[model samples]
Target: MTPTSALLSTRPWPLLLLLTLLLPGLVQAQQPTAVIAARATLSSWSDPLESLGTLRADESVTLSATVTDIVRELNFRDGDTVEAGRLLVRLADDEAQADLRAAQALRDERRNAVNRLAQLQSRNLAPRADVEDARAQLRQVEAEIQALEARLADYRIQAPFDGRVGFRNVSLGTLVTPGTELVTLDKLDVMKLDFTLPEVVLGQLAEGLSLTATSPAFPNAVFAGEIASIGSRVDPVSRSVTVRAELDNPELRLRPGMLMNVVVQRAPRNALVIPESALIPQGQRQYVLVLDEDDDYRVARREIGIGARRAGEVEVLEGLAEHDLVVAHGTERVRDGQTTRLLGILDDDTSIPELLRRGRDQAEANG
Candidate 1:
């Protein structure tokens, strides 16, 4: 070809545009599809035992006045963290104080009168019955005074424990009566979530069986705790046993009545695992999507036996090699030998304790 002919043929700009318009399918066939990319990972899946639970504090108490009185002063405000013996509310004690003073004065007077009567009786001036009457009067006054003091003390509301106080219900001068809901007090520094788990695996759950928890208040965050209490007997009807775990809520962030999901960690000395979302069930078989580098990803139907389901992940038993990535998502849509785009890799080999600690830090930072 001549120089001009070569230059004319070299112009791919116009030809490319024509091919784009005329051969759309041919052009598209040469391109790659990034259909909801998901990372391939090997996860050790443990047989999962699903359990339902309700969130609750280990110890929660509501404050109420036992006597009818006007609130003189609220020593502590709402959300106040109080120590044991901390005074919370004080009722109008003017009448009680007056009564106590009168009782004391009358007791003193009766004692003096009794002494005088005893002296008279010894000198044969007063009768034995008179002395006995005086002594009885003094004893009556003393008893009365003690009773008044006891009643006076009840006028003050105190913290029964080292705990956090709820919002104030009755402010200063608010008339409150017996059974009046004053406020809620809870020991949140350490909280417990009472739950029930299937009693079939009683051996799996015991003291020191690890656990992880997360609440809606802080999503993507896990709180750490241990199996604190286990019921001695399992209910035959429900086939479930009560399990309670104590969580260190030092910041008082996790409150009672806050719903949460708990994961009990069974120790894995040398475990295989993968992301939970990666596993898809087809009939009786479960599998994951895995990529072998390049665009050479495949929907691998893995026969994985699992151990424990925890924190959006699971432990695997069979049908997967270490580091052999299984697809995380879209396994149902993918077929064996089909191509896939590698999305991201999830940590399936990290120590459970490390994972728990990292989750706790994330929760604290967010909180």
Candidate 2:
């Protein structure tokens, strides 16, 4: 007998055990590995520019008294919303009111005298000079009444615009004078966000560019706004330009002097994007398994240049094209030139188990 046959016969059980182990490996090597893949798609991508910003009211003012007097009537409380021309405070105007009434009564008497003089002069009983003098006296009294009315106005304080008032600085019976801050008023229906950006990006900035802002106070809420104005001149010291954005504050959630994080959204352009899971990092290099449908769905390892990433997606700058299928799951079981069974295309919501179950059901129905 041949030497090989003799050895095999002497160790028959050992040979059988080796064959049993080798048979499954050979079968497994030939079977296609099931994998879920995603197609690289052209999607809108915006390069976001981030910076710190401060929130400001659309209009703000410090309300104060215009004259020195004791506070008589307090028309507004702390944090009261008022409209334009709303009465807010009335100083002690008793003396001014009394003077106005006296002047008005004197004006009435002078007018009656002028009328009576004119009636007599028409009959040639009164001289024309006397009639003219009476008319002049009436005009003088009317001017005095006007002066007193203006004086009374200075004793009252009214809102200049529609806004919300801050805490009261003066209380009832408190004596106040010109420039004494009584309160603060701010238009809170719309808020202004001011931030600075490097002048290098001035070419890309324009009024009406959309942006988003966020505050630590509201973790989950995102506020939307648009650029309202750009600073006319760049700041020489910082080499940056101030940008103002307007945000509607219908809920009054944004307040003045609040710190916010701003993200300026530049123009969007179409870019090739794939699922982030498709990336395989190898020593600072990113690689992905691209499926070749023309070659029996064989996978080819390709190096790709990556750019910005957001959520579960990544921007592929190179080595990928629109509609190119890449393995998104089960990448570990794949190799170059290895045939793979495509379960389905993956999306933002689908899972690997769901794709496997779908593939199995299809196979069963076909069988």
Candidate 3:
């Protein structure tokens, strides 16, 4: 009390009052701030066209019985990989087999008659008409046998191509008729993806161009493929063209009807690239707080022109130069020409874009 009162008593009352008011602001200005940052760099950027697509099997079909019969055997299980011509299902073929046998016996008997008649004709004992009639009977019996054999083939269901079989709808001993679906077969070694894009970009698209695709089923995996075909005409209503690409799926992980996100790179050019998180959009203008060139710890707001974005990076068309530092995080806490101490420079591998994505993933997991 004595020291504080002595100092206060010697100072003017106005001076003491003024000092008390300034102390809080001085302390606030000196407080340390923690934030993440990145440098604007000169790099080549491609306008990556993104679109939603559907994955389809290279070949697919619903295996169905061609004729009405009771199922005798099912040689495949649900989701089994099979080769072309592999026997899939067998129907009760007893009646078909009996018919074939009867046809064969009749043909054999007719052949014997034809031989006897031919011998008689050579000896001039039987008329030539008799030999001709026997020969015609033999030919008719052979035709009946051929028809029965063809009908017999319908009882055995075989795979049309190499593929994976889906769940069976009809089990052994189940009565099935023609056009009844038994199972589904899909060739998954390669997948076809169909997507649509604006007709304006059609001139840039061509066959054999490489593309990448990602699916929600396997978020961490990326599948690479190439453009297999392009649409011949653009849709008048949507003014878009349908594109089809083929992806090699050696692991057979991708299945038909799965939705995928596709990225197609087009028109590469050199530009100033920055983390997409650094752009601060306000009203109709965009801004970035760039570190001051003279004072590395200070930042100043600058309006920027932006172009196409891909991954976690955005193309800076103007108002920024290579090698300029920009505050990527904690922008709301910063002001133009304010002093800021960067926690540390962003790691080359840990860009702000990737970090933001990780943050979003964590939030989703937590929820």
Candidate 4:
């Protein structure tokens, strides 16, 4: 017999088979264990409703001239905050002033004549017809003066309300006509956001319903508002109902005509939650490897039912019990029925003494 064949024949066949069977187990045990851990938590979860909206001024108007006239003086600078009844513009009133003076003189003359006529009538020195005529003339002259005074008021422009004004379209010598655009005034103490929602959701849209909005201009900031009004009818074309919301704008950061993303919350409920990293998908099924209740740190695959997700957390609708530890951070390296090492629960960083106590307990249990 050859030397190699003789040596192989001397070794027992049962012993050789046993060693081959044990080799795979030894190699698996020597492999480094992946470290990943998370404890399931109970948390509040709500499915958020979202929609697109537009921001608007609470109150807005365009200032204009009441009559045709040349602008003689401007009382406000562009983009100035003004108070109610503050003069904004003055129009040239030279011709109106001349007519007013003439009317006043005629009124004064008529008044003198009426006084004389009254005295004459009391003395019975003049006929009743003459006194009546003189009094009628006085009335006509006083009416004329009043008409002139009313006309003069048209030359002055004043703010109808307290607000901020935009740029003026006319200059000092520019002549403006009635209905001519002068400037814009907006009351910005509060802002109105108008948007539409599908008619199917009419039950959810109501006065006092709270909502939140965000804008690209202020990406990190969120504005809170409430539904102020609902439209009487839904638009036939879009099948949506218009809704308006009011938001307090103390800082005046939000401006009209800005596009915003809006979110509304409905009824919320408490649910068990876990980090999204703990999930693993295979074929058409989703699962998580939870640490088995043993000192060996073995993990088992668990199928889970999921619900609405927000931020980095996912709601566990089923299959996950509270306080159950699962592989979260290093799920990619974990396998079903595989050995692993505990790195503490996710986000469980705390005092060093607690960590040491946990380590000692685990060691004692394993030993």
- Which candidate leads the pack in lDDT? 2
Per-model CA lDDT versus the true structure: 0.74, 0.91, 0.88, 0.84
Query: TM-score order of candidates, best first?
Result: 2, 4, 3, 1
Cα-based TM-score, every candidate: 0.60, 0.80, 0.64, 0.65
- TM-score for candidate 1, please give it: 0.60
Candidate 1 lDDT over 104-142, as tens digits, reads 988889999999999999999999999998999888888
lDDT of 3 by residue, 277-302 (tens): 89999988889998864775787899
Each prediction's number of clashing residue pairs: 22, 0, 0, 0
Instruction: Kindly provide the TM-score of model 3 when superposed on the true structure, using C-alpha atoms.
Output: 0.64
Error of 2 at 108 (Å): 2.4
Better of 1 and 4 by lDDT: 4
Report RMSD (Å) for each prediction in the order shown.
11.6, 4.5, 8.6, 7.8
lDDT of 3 at 185: 92
lDDT: worst 10-residue window of model 2: 344-353
Off by over 4 Å in 2: 1-22, 117-139, 277-288, 292-297, 300-312, 316-323, 330-332, 351-367
Across 5-36, the per-residue lDDT of candidate 4 in tens digits comes to 99899889879899999999998788757565
Candidate 1 vs candidate 4: which has greater TM-score?
4
Residue 267, model 3: lDDT of 71
